[model samples]
Structures are given as structure tokens and as C-alpha cells.
Target: MKRKNILLGAFALLLVLGFGSCQKSDLPLDGTVSKERIAALQSNLKKALHDTTQGWVMMVQGLNANVRTAMPVLLKFDTLTGDVTTRTLFSKDKQSSKFVLSASTGVPLLSFSTFSYISQTYTAANTAITDFFFKVLDVTADSITIQPFRKGNIYQSEGGAIMKLFRASSDKMKWALDLLNAPGNTGNIFTQTSLFGRDLEVRLKASFATDSIRSRTGFYSWGGSLNVVKSNTPITRTYPTLNPIVIEFYTTFPIPANAVPLDVNTVVGDGLIYWQPTTALTPADYFLNGPNATINFLKTDYLLIKSMTANSVEVYAVDASGNVCITGRIGD
Candidate 1:
């Protein structure tokens, strides 16, 4: 009788253990639901960036310390790959780069592996800042709202520096390009003057000057044709296409009164040199070289329009590293 009782007890314990094992295996506690959600969000993000008829624009503030509230950036995402192209006042040309889409701690985030035009400026300005990853907070048909991932950066700890991406059309894209390209008072090629007459005053803020001149200094202008002036020496370059505008000193002509000669020789001028618009080159490349290439103003990669009028314009130059190398006013 005792042996039979022991056998029954052993069988009952085995059955209980089997049931417990089965229950654990069948429990709904796996991360399947969260994983599905993350996948769905990633798909949605890819579609949002690439499926639309046009690109997207985001007004990013807090990226630069010197500027105002924000700067606008345009981005186009590739439909077939993780490639991205960006247009900004940071450069005269468009930038092509790639980004990464990653899932972290049950959230989807986007980051740039290569330095896009926008990232170049942002990271260059803030040395301690590294990540450009934006946490996907929300998305809509026309907009995506994102905040920087909490990675011990300014946007994460200080908070409220959220970036908003909005849909942009083809026409909007063209307009943005045009705005960044325009460099003269007229802001177009057709409006360049025959001679940058005495009316052609320059407010130079070149890299070497003691202080940026507020008052417009008188200068002369002639089209591509060479014209000798009595006292004022205007930078002689092809107007409406000031591509090869020369900043060399003219022994025959003196610089405007109280005006410092705008030369690469005087400053650490290895960047963008200022020039007005021209017909042959709507957006032209300019070089500021000193005697025998001793000084090279090769750092200027950007021309930004600050303000404009019928006869007057305000502009500045920024290098690839987000340094505003020069700012000046032009006009009557």
C-alpha cells in the first residue's frame, strides 16, 4: 500500500511541473507588441520622407550661437536608400549625404552618419555637441515633429529645442535655391549696373579689418569692359556675372576715402569673397588671392543675404565651419 501511494504522489508532482512549464511558454509577456510598433513607425518614417511629391523643410534653431532664433534647412530623402540631400545658406552648392534609421529602447530615431550641410554648421559651431539624432516624437501627413534624443546634449537636457519638418513643393524648393544663390542688391543677374559708380558703395567687413565699416565707402563699377577712373578704384569684374571679379590693388586708382583696401593680403582671408550677381554666372565662384598666392581667401563657401532694397543690400559670407567670415552692405 505504501509503495502504491508513493507512485501516485510522484505522478501528481510531474503533472504539476509540466503544466507550469507550458503556462510560462504561453504567457503574453514577450516584447512582440512593442517590436511591431517600432517596425510600423520606421516604415511610416521612410514613407513620409521619400513618398511625397516634394522635399521637406525644417527650421532649426539653437543650432548656431551667433544667429537669431533659427535657420531654415531643406532636405530630400532618397526613396530607394538612406541617402539625403540638403540645401542651406551654409553653402553655394547642394550637399549629398546619408543618414541612419535606428530603433532604441522601443523608440525609432534618425541620425546622420555623414556630415550633411546642416550638420557641418551645427557641429562646427558647438564643439561638445556631436549627435544629430532626433527622437521621433510624432508624425503627420504634412509634418514630423522631433526632439533631440536624450544623449546629454543641449537639446535633450535643456529641452524645448524641438525641430519641425514640414512638406515642401517643387516650386518652394526652387525658390529656396534662388534665395540662397542671389548675391547682389538687385538679387538677380539682369540688374547689375554698368559701372559700380560712386553710387557703388561698399560696407566691408573683411576678415582683416579693424572694425566692420558701417558707412558705405564709395567705389566705381564697369561691366566686363575695363574703365579707368580718376580717384576711385572699383573692383573690375564682369557685371551681372561677377565670376572673375579682381580685388587686386590698382596703382592708378586709389581706394575710396577712409576705406581699407578689400584684399586677402590684409586678413586671414582664405574663404568666400563677396561679389554681386552676373549674367553668365548666377551663382559664381570667387577667389581672393594675394600677390603670388601668398594669401588665399579660400574659406568663404557661403553668401547669405541679410537685407535688401532697390538700391542697397546687406550680405555676409560664412565658411564651411559656420564661421561668418565677412558681412557687408552694398548700394547707393
Candidate 2:
């Protein structure tokens, strides 16, 4: 009887152990985010926007290098009226429009629901254009980071100047249409860049539209030594225009205008020429033009500038893996 009791007790203990092991380690306590919790978050976001005085200041980078450079924009949100007052370097007057906050796949989106100056503008081809919804990526005390988002999370990656916003203060707002118009104040001519320790020529036009091709010759921010004369022989571009081609993947999504006004470089050291084409052509001597003047081929390059002053700008050009491919100065 004692032996039988010992075996039964051991089996019972085994059963207890098995049941304890099966008790589902409590599923990691990531915390169950209920519907109420999401609503609370959305409400808090709106509160932050409404509490600000000067609203928000953002240097908005447009859809696929449209502005020739990042354009400063101000958005003053009135949550009570579901309205947002918008301003930009492109327009002097404040334009009011409707805005809505909603959630998609657990992420909140701030969308311009009506025509606003920042959203609605004249295209380079002189047609109507609109900049659509923004995904609220993060919110801090003084700033908000947003991503230009299309429906279904397409091209949903975060990048460029449009990603950040600062609560605009009286002291921080320092841009106007007139301030951007003066070329001597807006940008400096940068003609010398380096790649692989070799210096390259790069002269920026006072205005790409009216200048002769020779005046704007030399290489792009992403070029190499000699790299050959940036143009092939027998080519000439008397008048040039930076054209913005639409990325067709954004179906049903409102896109920004393809307008690069003559004085679009509001910031001195921040311009990326993703797609630029002259009226005719420039120097006639490059086998690989990256993407600047190439026809139909799509390879992207940018001008990463820093430490800009009245005389010089530290130019940076990176390779595919983010390694510094080109480094030098373009200054007096």
C-alpha cells in the first residue's frame, strides 16, 4: 500500500508540473490597447496642436524634389473649429482650410480635407495640385515629426525636411516671400566639389531658367574627378527649367505641386536636385549623368550641404550605403 501511494503521489506531482508549464506565461504584457486608449491618444494630440500660439513651423520638402529646395510652411491648427491656417514662402496671405484627425491601422493621420494654400497650388505645367495627409510619427514637447503618407501605407517611409515641425514662436519665425526673393541672401554659388580626393567643377546658375548652359556647366553634387566634362560635345542649353515628373504609384492620393519658383532656395545649404532638365542641354560630355539630365533612366542623387556661410559651404555627397562619396567646398 505504501509503494502504491508513492507511485500515485509521483504521478499527481507530474500532473501538477505539466499543468503549471501549460499556464501560458501570461503573453508578454505588451499591454492591451483598447479602443478607449486610442481615442485618448488622438484627443491628446489635438490638444497639443490647439495649445500652441504661433502654431507650427515646418520646412516642407515637396513630392519628389518639386520645390528645388525645402519651403518653409506654417500651420496654425484650431481643433475646436477643425480648421488649420496655413502659410508658405510661396504665398504671403494665410489661407484657412479644414483638417481631420483619424486613425488607420492604429496610427493617427492629420489630413487636409479642403483646399488650403499649402496644399492647393499651381503646378509648373500650370494646373491645380494638392498635398494630402500626413502620418503623425512622433510628438514631443516642442516638435512633431510627420511623414508624408498615401493611402494603404504606400511610399510611407519617412525622409527629407517634411518630417519635422516646431511649435512656432515669435522669435523663431524668420521667413517671408520677400526674404527668399533676394539671390544674394538666399543661396551662394558652389562650383568646387570633391570625389575620391579629386576636385570637380560645379557652378550653380544665378537662375537656371535664363542662364546659358555654359554659365551652369560643371558636375552635379554627385559627380567624380574629370568625371569628364559634365556634358557631351555639341550640346547647349540656352534656357533651363527644373521639371518635376510625377511618381505614378500614388493613386487616389493628393500630391504636391510641381512648381520650383525662381527663388525657391529659402534655406542656404539645403537643396537636392533630384530631377532637373535644361531647356535644351548643357556641357556635352558625360557617360553617366546620374539622374540630372538623363532621359527615362531613374537614378537619384542629392546635394548634402552644411556649415554654409557668406563665403563657403561644406558639400557632402554620399554613396548608396551612406558612405561619404564626395566631400569638398563650394565657395569664394
Candidate 3:
């Protein structure tokens, strides 16, 4: 009789514990309805990504820079056959590899299932384009948006890495590349314009190293063309009575417009390139050309790219903390 009573007591305790485990909050648990809706959404996105018949253009935040520095890449996905083709702004090689679409963590996650250049973008010691295990945010007939899915990832807020993929045409990809490399587009000068479109004289913020912003009338210049040369005296300056100083800056190296020419000394030493006041900022020949140009600058936290215009583009420089240190608008 006692054994029976003890058994009944144990069963009652188990029931109470099970009931207490489900402490409800504001979450809706209509159960089947919610689960079905999620499943349907996942199914729709899967179909869109897998059916990349015409290829897709993906716009993601520059791995080492900000959204303003975003670029597009071409992608072709085939989960059924388990392979993907991808291209980036820096490399033209069409990397192919096995990929997977899964719900292993309760949400749709897409990742390269093998070792390939596509995965290298994320795993590479230099670039941080972590789209490997992309968490699907939204999907439509022609486009899908995604963000990196690092478990306990803390860098998302500091660096905006959200990406969007759209159905792409061949012409669009060509245009993106052309805009980045248009002749004289990057090396052109940028200055603040007044209300009447007059060039405003930029005054540099006073510093312990220098006094008076007028120390240099031309605050910015683009390098990188062997064709047109930097003047013997690129900048003519005016200084205050406390510190009257005259300085001339010039360069002969093939410094690209979208880059700062750095001598070997600079690269191995401080590795910081201040865009405004220097001669031959960084040597262009020292590095490879094309999309790699941007990657090289990213190593030092300096991003110079042609603006998205036929006659104009902007140059932006950032500090180690990912904040904009200086900006100039170059125009023809």
C-alpha cells in the first residue's frame, strides 16, 4: 500500500514540474498556424535562391568599410546539385564550390559547405565579408536580404554588414565596374562649394603639430596616373603670425586617383596614410591592380574609390575605430 502511495506522489510531482516549466510570456503560441507560416516563408526563399537561372547581383557592406563603400558581386546558386559560382569587386575568377541550405538552427541558413574562395572572403585573415552562413532576413520574387549569422557576434552594430541580393543583368555588373575605374574620375579634385557653386577654401582643424588651416589652400589631391603629373608644388599655403610656414608637396610615382601613394617606409612603419598633407602617399605599383586596390587600402583603414558618377566621385578616409576621418568630393 505504501509503495502505491509513493508512486502516486512521484507522478503528481512530475506533472507539477512539467506545468511550471512552461512559464508563458507575450509570445503567441497558436502552434500550427505560426509554424506553418514560417515554413511557407522559408520554402519561398529557398526556391528563389536555388533557382538562380540568370545569376544574381549581391550588394553587401564592404567587408572592411561602411555602407557608403558598398560594392556588388555576382552569384549563381544551385543547392540541388550543390555548387555555387561567385565573383567580387576585386577578383574576376568565378569560384565554384559546394553549398548548403539548411534549417539546422531553426531558421533558414545558407553557407558554403566546402573550402572555396567564396568562403575565403569570410575566413580570410584580411577581409571580413562574412556572408558564408547568411541568415535570411527577407525574400521576394526577385530579391533577398541577408546578414551574417555569427553566434554571439558583437561586431554587427559597429560595422554595418547587412547585405541585399537582387536579380541582375550583365549590363548592370559592367556599369558597376566601369564606374569604379573610369579614367580621371578618381584623381579629379574635390572642394566644398559655396551657394553659388564656388570652391570654398577648406581650413584644416588646428592641431599641436600645425597651426592655421590655411597652411594649405588645397586640402586634397588624387594620385595614381602616370599620364598627368602632380605639380612641383601641389599645395601653396598661408599661416598665422604665431607660426608662419610655407610647404610644398608633390609626387612622381604612379599614384592612382583612388589611393594614397605610400613609400615602403610608411607601410612597414606607422601604416597610417593621412590623405591631406603628403607627397606620393602610397606607391600604386607596390600593390596589384583592380579590386585588390580597395582590399589593399582596407588593410590600413584607408578607402579611396571612384564615386558613382561619370564626372565625379568621392574619397573617404577612416580611422582605426571605423569612423570617418576625412572626406573630399572630387569632380571634373
Candidate 4:
């Protein structure tokens, strides 16, 4: 009886040990994530965005000729606990662009662009800030399909560039993931501008209205041919005619309280310009003289001259070399 009891106890102990081993095997083991790995991933993502030779450089180069003409002033990046932020400043307009990313997923989450430019002595302010929430819709060992929740606003110029960057970067990302084995073609042309610019151009089509010319308006009208000169010689000449009139009118009447002056310099320098309203003027109160010509104004205590009686006006012309010459200002 004693030997049988001993045998039973030994069998029970063996069964307990076997069950414990099975339970331990069924539990999942922790896959540890190290700080060093996270840091390396962040670095790689930053390099991909700002890489001049291979990455976003191509996308940035495709910005409108005017925007690209201005050089960048500063480009900086900062690493946080699990994210990275990059900032850039442009030289011409002191414009800035910022980008933020997640370290773990190597995904971009936010982007912002801001700038102020002077046109015809008036200041124009522009800002665009966008947020992107990247959700992994599908993932495999070699590829990922992500749905981006994009929310933000942008000025016309920077908006176009941002759209282009997104499209180009998406294509590049796929190529990078494929180890460059994929073809270099993105279905869309890299040279095309955003749809927004195209829509704006269409909306601003030329129109005409006829009414009796108001007297004592204190209007100053200037018109000149736009001639592209290379090596001090005219390459292309765009003549000004009476059909499409470009004029600048100044008035101190009870203009709307929300009137804002357009930046004349930015308009003439760049093809398009935008302005915000102050108590003096609103953007809506301003009108373009011609479809091709952009108009902007400055705030002055008073209009220098109130009225003109002549059928025609005479104005001084400054040549490209800064030589002042007298030109006959013809009226329509």
C-alpha cells in the first residue's frame, strides 16, 4: 500500500510539470522595440524627404517657374520623442514651409507654408497649413497602401507646389520600397501644375462693362508694351491695345470699410496676387482692369489729383535701364 501511494504521487507530479510547460509555450513572447531602431528609421525618413539628388528634390524643382526662381533661406529639422519636424525659409519673400512626420511609421502628418511679399509698395500675406493622417489600409512585407486624411488650406502658389509634391513623393515611395526595381514612370506628368491654378485662371476670364466715365475720380492710368529683351534686344513683344485696357484708379470716396489694397508689385512681377482686407479696403472691393492685367492699390491720405478733363493723358515712361522718357497715354 505504501509503495503504491508513492508511485501515484510521482505520476501526479510529472503531469503537473508537463501542463505547466505547455501553458508557457502557448503564451506569446514579447518582441521588444529598441530606441536605436526608432532613431535610425526617423533619420532615413528625413533623408528621403530632403534628398537633393533622388527624393523630393525633383518634386520641388517642378514648382512654378516664378516660385522656384526664389532661393530658400533656411532649412532645418528637429527630432522629438517619436516625430520629426522640418522648416524651410525662402529668400525673396521670407516664405516658410514646414513638414512633420511620425518616427515609427515613417509617415508625414503635417505641412505648412507661409510668406509675405511686397507688390507696388503694398504688402501681401499668404499662408497654407495642411494636416495628413496616414492610415494603413493594407500592408505586406514589401508594399503598403495607405489612405491619407488630408485637411488644410493653402495659398494658390504654394498649394500647387504642395499637390505636386504629394503626387511625386507617392510615386517615389513606391519605387524606393521596390528597391528601385520598379520603373521610374509616374502615370502623371511631373511638369504639370495643380488643378487649382487651372481653375483660378478659368474663373478669372475677361469680361467687359460699359458705363459713362465718372469725373473727378482721381484716376492714374499707365500702359506699356511688355517686351522680353535678351542681351539688350527685344525677343518677344506684347503690344498694348485699346480693347483690353490696364488702368489704376485712385479714389477716397466712402469706399467699403473692408476694402484691402492688392500688392501691385507682386501682380506685375508675378502673374497673380492675393490680399487680405483691412478697414480701408477689401479684396472684393478691388477689381482687375483687364483679364490679362492685374490691379492693386495703396492706402494714401488723399488722391494727388482728383479729375482730368482731357480726352488723352500724358505720362512719363521709365525704360528698363531706368531712363525716363515721355509717352503719350492713349484713352479707350
Give per-candidate clash totals: 17, 7, 12, 9
Model 4: per-residue Cα lDDT over 1-332, one tens digit each: 99999999999999998887674454334533434444554455445444432222111121112111111112222333222222111111222233445533433332222221111011111111122333233322222333333322343221222322221234433432232222232211111112111111001101111221121112222235222111111000111110111123323224456644222211111111111221222232332122112211121100111112233222222211212222222222
Q: Rank by TM-score, descending?
A: 1, 2, 3, 4
Q: Model 4: residues >4 Å from true position, as ranges?
A: 1-44, 53-99, 103-106, 113-162, 166-283, 287-332
Sorted on lDDT, best first, the list reads 1, 3, 2, 4
CA shift of 308, model 3, Å = 20
Better of 3 and 4 by lDDT: 3
Model 3's TM-score against the true structure: 0.44
Question: Tens digit of lDDT per residue, candidate 3, span 239-260?
Answer: 0011101112113223345543
lDDT per residue as tens, model 1, 146-239: 7655434455453235666877664434444445455534343123344233444555576645655443332333244323211111122111
Q: Give me the displacement of residue 102 in model 3, in angstroms.
A: 0.7
For this target, which candidate reaches the highest lDDT against the unseen true structure?
1
Candidate 1 C-alpha error for residue 193, in Å: 17
lDDT score, candidate 2, position 223: 32
| Model 4: worst 10 consecutive residues (lDDT sum) | 233-242
> In model 1, how large is the Cα lDDT of residue 113?
62
**Candidate 1 segments whose C-alpha is farther than 4 A from its true place:** 1-28, 63-69, 125-130, 150-160, 170-303, 306-312, 315-332
lDDT computed for candidate 2: 0.43
